[model samples]
Target: MPALKSVTDATFVDEVLLAAGPVLVDFWAPWCRPCRAVSPVVEQFAARNRGKITVVKLNADENRETTGTYGVKTIPTLMLFRSCREVSSIVGAPSRKALEAKLREML
Candidate 1:
């Protein structure tokens, strides 16, 4: 699997907003069971679509600024960004097939 990078509030702009292509930001927290459950699926999706998209993980507990700015009320939020704006989002732990289908449709 491709290594998923970690993003912080300080790096959010350079990493996601100004990225050359689409970015998949996985907003999660370490203590959140749902977040842990979906992590592998997210990583696998990233690996399969490596060159087509950039995937990053943002810890909701650690990055309050970006989390608040994005209004991420729930853990395991998957946000897709293109041209510095969010185009799609998934709010919870979805099955691999479900996640893939949703992302495929968006991409």
Candidate 2:
């Protein structure tokens, strides 16, 4: 199973931005119910798109710089990045199909 990695400010560049492939960054926090609810979906999406995309999660509370830079005002915000540039964003809990479609397009 492909597991969604938890990234911090320390690893943001090496793990997500500078990675070899496209990435889906989930900006979330422990207190967010929607974030918790979509965790499984993101995990499964990561598993299915293992080679084509990378899935990661960042805690908004801990990574203020990244959060503010990305303009993430809500919990459970998902940002799609390629070549170190953000291409798209999805807020809230999206269906697996919806998430996959976005990732697939990016890949």
Candidate 3:
């Protein structure tokens, strides 16, 4: 299984922006219920798409620069990036199927 990597403002650029494949970044905070609720889906997606995509989790509370750069005003925001460019985003708690479908489309 592909484990989810924790990303901070310091590593965001190298981990997500410069990655070779599509990146699914989950912008969340520990205190957020919705963020926690959607975490499993993100993890499963990561494991399933292991070789095809890179999955990262960014704590919005701790990563101010990253949260600000992405203009993420909401918790549990999911951004899909390819070649360092954001291609799609799903806000709120999306199901595993929905997220997988999006990743499939990107792949």
Candidate 4:
């Protein structure tokens, strides 16, 4: 199963921005309760939709520059990128059903 990949400021450009398929970047922090709450859904989606898109997690605490650049002011923000540009986003912890709905519209 494809797993959720961890990203940092150093690799954000190449890993998410320049990626071929749509990249879902989950901006979160280790200490954020809501961030932890949504992690399982993100992981399952990552494995199930492995070929459809790229799922990555960026720890806002460790990757301050990238988080600031992306305008991620909230924890558990999920941003979708295509062709090096951001196309859509989800802020806060959402239900798996809700997240799936958003993914459908974006994908």
Candidate 5:
């Protein structure tokens, strides 16, 4: 299974923006219930799309800079970045099928 790499304000630029392929960034906080709820779905999506896209998590609480830059006002926000720009975003904890459908559209 592919594991989600944790990205911080310091590494966000290189890890997400400069990545060679599409990246799915999960902006979450440890204390967020919704974030916890969506964790498994995100993990499953990452594992299934391992070679097609890169998946990373950014703690909104700890990575304030990147969170602010992206205007992430909510936890469990999923952003799809392509060619250094945000191509799509999902702001809530969506079901596996819903999330996959949305991401498939974006990809």
Candidate 6:
């Protein structure tokens, strides 16, 4: 299974913006219960779409710049970035299947 890569404020541009395929940025905080609930679903999506899409996790508490710039007011927001631009997002804990369905629309 493909693992989730951690991204920091410093590496956000290089990791997400520069990526060729769609990048799913999981903006989450460690203390968020909903974020913890969504973690596994994000991981499974990463593994399933290993080559087609790149999944990266950013801790909102640690990486304030990227999180704040994106206007993420929620802890478990999943933003879909394509060609260095924001395409769409889901802002809560969602089942793996549901997440994948919405992500497929982005792809």
lDDT of 6 by residue, 1-107 (tens): 55588999999999999987889999998899989888887787788778898889999999888888999998799999988999999998777788778877866
TM-score of each: 0.95, 0.87, 0.88, 0.91, 0.92, 0.90
Please identify model 4 stretches exceeding 4 Å from their true place.
Answer: 1-3
The better-scoring model by TM-score among 2 and 5 is 5
Report the lDDT tens digits of candidate 3 across residue range 1-107: 55578999999889999999888899998899988888877787678777988889998999999899889998889889888889889888767678667657766
> In model 6, which range of ten residues has the least summed lDDT?
98-107
Which candidate wins on TM-score?
1
Give the distance in Å from residue 6's predicted Cα in candidate 2 to where it truly belongs. Answer: 1.2
How many Å off is the CA of 63 in candidate 3? Answer: 0.6
lDDT of 1 by residue, 1-107 (tens): 65589999999999999999999999999899999888988888888888999999999999999999999999899999999999999999878889778878767
**Model 3 error, position 17 (Å):** 0.4
lDDT of 6 at 43: 86
- Return the number of clashes found in candidate 4: 0
The local distance difference test score of model 6 is 0.87
Question: Which residue pairs in candidate 3 collide?
Answer: none
Off by over 4 Å in 2: 1-3, 95-97
- Model 1, residue 33: distance off in Å is 0.7
TM-score of 4: 0.91
Better of 2 and 4 by TM-score: 4
Itemize residue pairs with steric clashes in candidate 6.
none
- Candidate 2 C-alpha lDDT tens digits along 19-101: 88888999999999889988887787788777888889999999998898889999898898888889888888877788667
RMSD of 2: 1.8
Report the Cα lDDT for residue 45, model 4: 76
Model 2 alpha-carbon miss at residue 91, Å: 1.0
